[model samples]
Target: MRTRLSRALPAAVAVLAVFSALPVSAATAAVREPVPYASPVDHPSYIVTVRRDLDPADVARLVGVTPVHVFDTALHGFAARLNPAQVAALAALPGVETIEEDGTASAG
Candidate 1:
């Protein structure tokens, strides 16, 4: 049994090393792109209303887009240029309240 035991020790250790490394490998996995970035948002701008409970910047990072116009205390949203894919990503964010297209209105 001595010969058999010696061979198994190295194999056991190798298994342990590989299993221990699984979490780190999974943690570092690349994030897949959510949007194809084909069509842009309506009129090249969208109003993103975020949850009242979280910071808008936090939602921004999750959506992977930058806001060109940020509303102040009067509102809880920001305006940004986004493609259809990006808008979908923004809408999927955890704390996002709503997303709407910004457009010009005529006063006749």
Candidate 2:
């Protein structure tokens, strides 16, 4: 009886650990609330500013979009076409700094 119990203990512990981690992973995968864009557009362009440590391309990939432009030197960010849901997910990311609509600047 002792030998049987001992042999099962490690396996049981491993199974328990795996099961306990499932909920946390599932919670993280839950759908995030959609963040409305500053202006309404079918597929709006956004300039996403991220933390220095994060790569703009990687961030774009995570949100399932290809970046139209990647800025690395002066700014750490990327410009991409995104919808409201993508905007929300990108906003919720840890290293994202700001998400703003891409706009034109003209000299006066």
lDDT of 2 by residue, 18-103 (tens): 98877776867878889854534578889999999888999999989999899998889998889999999998999999999898
Candidate 2 segments whose C-alpha is farther than 4 A from its true place: 1-41, 106-108
Per-residue C-alpha lDDT of model 1 across residues 1-108, encoded as one tens digit per residue:
256877889999999999887887586688775864433535378878887777776677666778877775877878888788888888677778888877766999
lDDT of 2 at 90: 95
Model 1 spans with C-alpha error above 4 angstroms: 1-43, 106-108
Clashing pairs in 1: none
Count: clashes, candidate 2: 0
Which numbered prediction scores highest in TM-score against the true structure? 2
How accurate locally is residue 105 in candidate 2, as Cα lDDT from 0 to 100? 75
Tell how far residue 91 is off in model 1, in angstroms: 1.6
Error in Å for residue 50 of model 1: 0.9
